[model samples]
Target: MRAYETRRGARLSAALMLALAVGACGGSTEKAEGEKPHAAAADYERGPHRGRMLRDGDFALEITLYEEGPAPLFRLYAYQNDKPLDPKGVQVNIALTRLGPKVDRFTFAPEADYLTSPAIVHEPHSFDVAVSAARAGRTHKWTYASYEGRTTITAEAARAGGVTTERAGSAMLGETLPLNGRIEITPEGKSDVVARYPGRVVSMGVELGERVRRGQVLARVESSESLQTYSVTAPISGVIVEKNVTVGGITGGQPMLVIADPTQLHAEFFLYPRDAERVRVGQPVEVTSLAGDHRLASRIEAILPTADLTNQTLVAHVPLSGPTETWRPGLGVKGTVSVGANAAPLAVRTKAIQPFRDFEVVYAKVGNTYEVRMLEIGRRTPEWTEVLGGLEPGTEYVVDGAFLIRADIEKSGASHDH
Candidate 1:
């Protein structure tokens, strides 16, 4: 019985030794051979179910991949919860790479030419991507710039979301149609210079054909409400074309005297709905009064969207260049608006750019430097001149006090760097 018991103990000890030897071999294989039997299972648990988090500068990018139908679809999302991200200066690039033989060629949806492959059909595929761009400076500190002669707004809004009413001048993509325009005199704008509180005309400073400046007193009116005879100044300076009331006439709401600023005497031209589409609020126009001698230069102002029911025409206002004495209401005037082809080049404000002999020059504000660029020239009018070449659209160019900055740039030899 003692001998049988000792044999049983020896067999149990041998079994225990065999188990310890197997455990030691497994640990050695894991460390030196780097063979993880559970590696595929661990990757499957953590890879697709858990997304990859990526950070670039101030931007945070999150990419999630999940098996959808036949392919593993990836959904990419970007967030900047901690800080604001400027869209202007940021650029992103993405690439997909194949690791093992199982990985087929991968492709991006929506058909991007930059995509490397058609599609990843097998397992063990990886996507490598990066986000890189210049960080934009504070938008509020950006100065005023002009494109095609109009003002442009850049930078983020001073308010939370941003200024919705603000607009920036579009850069010139290519040759575009010149904006249609017409001109109007000052009195053409809406006004109510009626004799609302009229009295006796005590004095008359303006004559029938005299050109008056704005706010010039046309005549004086004396009423019980006005106390002593008070002067009624002209709301807009033009010419006193109509004198309805004499020195002693009692007046009420009727017009006491007709005062119209020739420059303000804008003619609201009724354009056919189709024709109006070619015209814009800032286009240049040539005005020829019925009298023929009164040739005036003007620009298209407001374009009323609603058409006249009776005339079926769109009404547009043209602001005249200067005060004129000849333009009067009911007097017909002929306006010639030049409608160019869609491929024609357009002019921008001359204030934003200056002429440098044969070439045009503008100061481009890049970083803290103002670089002067020589540009090609095109058609010219009084208000604006065309840009044939040199500057890109959407890029900020100094408009206000541009010449002063150009002088500074020239003095500092900023152009030497370029």
Candidate 2:
């Protein structure tokens, strides 16, 4: 009975393998045949005019795009047996199907030497084309694909590749002023420890850079007049930045120690004469460290009325809030002050912008396909860019991993051709 069961199981396994093989072969064959029609244009023959050449026996047609004039327009030339054919004798029509399955139809009119399309051929010269010609009561038709700045990836693949998208729409565009500054402790956050009277330091308990609490004993001072010793306590909880007095050192009016609270920090940005009028207190400022490893969102707290006598630059104080463990006094920082703002009808994430051909574009996604949208940009900030034209509102665009899509499209050998 055991032997019989084993033989039956072997037969079942063999059947399953055969079924999978047949399914795989059928799917592959179907996919190849389906792609052939679209793949033909990439391998189409080119005529002398550098346009795609479509031929049937002794009759041939050459299509070219004439863009040296006002706008891009299609020009067609006809031939018979390697000799020129009269453009008036042949009637032609062309259809272009774009990525969104939108179709554009064009009709040709005969000119002096060739037939020219009256309608302009829009940019991205990337589409599947269908051509029809009628001559002597016979009709000839050919279909091929030409694509550029476009690519198609499966949804699963796009997700795995980190390709994310967001709809393009209204955004607040802010105009900013660039300012350079350094982190500094607020005046109220720093303290200078001094003795009540002229005295000599008896025993110093706290060292430089030591963390101390308010009312904590920091040192023992013996007064020269009273002839007695008194404990000197910290006025504020902070780190000791300067220790001027050592044991047995005489302390008079000078500060014996300086303590600064790191948490009470602010960035001091300098404004030149041109920028002084634009900046005001309460304006939002984005401060970043010189190394760019840290960033904090702050606002201008105050603007000094007087300018520095040396450089004549005014100072704007922007207070840093939240956890400031990484912010250190005297650390150089850069700031962008949002002076003014306007609402733009269409905007996209600045990082989504990519260079495509002669245009700065963002990849608009529809389903599994991605295509470029050339932009006429307006005022731009580091986070968002205003779109003046060339993209429709509410269109989904790639916010991240846009380079991956561009790379895939380039790797597919898409080109700009007539």
Candidate 3:
């Protein structure tokens, strides 16, 4: 299944290759006189400063992104004929067109031995770069692509691949306490049918496992004192779980039938000493069957004051509603109780988070393109995760099928080359 999904993603990627070309920065389509096009930044030769070297005859400029400090900034080293050139002697301007077609322009000023860009280079560092420099009445220009953690897919293809998106915004993040329990019938939902007076059973009307309604005749008993026959009816509407009498059997002292209402059920979850203090009545809980195939949303209906002598744990009862076909008495269940919640200024769906390289990332969407946004995360719950940094609040991000984007980017061999 994984291989087939990957193939589908590859097809989608192929369909967007043409779109990528229009925004591609590799191999210059236009250049100045006597200037030649260069390969992408990944293939460019690194100068002594470890920055990509762009050359036009004897004049060359090495561009490096300096990030050792608080923020990333652009730095340029000028050279002539393999020898260092005076920084002040060269004038340079750079344009970076990001995935959203948003352009960031930077002008370089001579700083120490190299020209520096005062503006900070934002994260992702993936863009189409255009560099122009002038010195000694001569001009040099170059353009190349430097893309990483980015991929493009047509809208049609995205829908076909189940790709979905949502805007990053405020959300309530909850803190939960986990507990284990089992489904049980409520006390009021069960009843034991018995004869009103000592008598002999004349006829049994219901069998084990048979559903019955309240006041339905369960057995006909012949009273010993009156020496007359009377009907014993079900006290509650439920299924007959136990039948203790038959025709011609003596009743009165023992229950003739035991009926239990399956619909009125509750999950009794055990809270250890450490977690008991945090749980209270009326808090919401999410209960799932032991097999995890069924789930029900409920709230803590009550908490027993006394602890069980065997386990020394208090019981928290969560009432279950809706269809009870999957929830049977004695079936074990898992529960998550919401103890508290806090509002987060900016958050994203937890499902959108994916591991990219060394950081936890989510793919931000713009048109047909998607790029990684490494996040600084804070409090997290199963539904929403607080985003402390690396993403804008109103930005649209992939909420599903993010793995496909990551796979496509990896297939393109996008790297962190300087």
Best by TM-score: 2
lDDT value, candidate 1, whole model = 0.44
Q: How much is the lDDT of residue 247 in candidate 1?
A: 66
Q: What is the number of backbone collisions in each predicted candidate, taken in the order shown?
A: 27, 0, 1
C-alpha lDDT (0 to 100) for residue 213 of candidate 3: 93
- In model 2, residue pairs whose N, Cα or C atoms come closer than 3 Å (at least 3 residues apart or on different chains), thus clashing, are none
Decoy 2 TM-score against native: 0.81
Off by over 4 Å in 2: 1-41, 67-70, 110-112, 135-139, 321-325
Which residue segments of model 1 deviate by more than 4 Å?
A: 1-184, 187-206, 211-220, 225-228, 265-267, 283-299, 305-307, 322-418
What does candidate 3's lDDT look like per residue over 45-132, in tens digits?
A: 6799988778888888898988799988998999999799999999999998877667999998998999998898887787778899
Q: Would you list the clashing residue pairs of candidate 3? A: 25-145
For model 2, residues 321-363, the per-residue Cα lDDT tens digits are 7676688888898999999988988899999999988899999
Whole-model lDDT values for every prediction = 0.44, 0.78, 0.81
List model 1 lDDT by residue over 288-388, tens digit each.
77656887667777778544487577777765544445666566667766555333243455666765434576655443333344666575544455676
Candidate 3 stretches with Cα past 4 Å from truth are 1-10, 13-35, 38-42, 46-51, 59-122, 130-142, 154-166, 198-207, 219-231, 243-256, 273-280, 306-312, 400-404
Residue 377's lDDT in candidate 1: 57
All-Cα superposition RMSD per candidate: 28.2, 10.0, 6.2
lDDT of the structure predicted as candidate 3:
0.81
Q: How should the candidates be ordered by TM-score, best one leading?
A: 2, 3, 1
Q: Which candidate comes out best when scored by lDDT?
A: 3
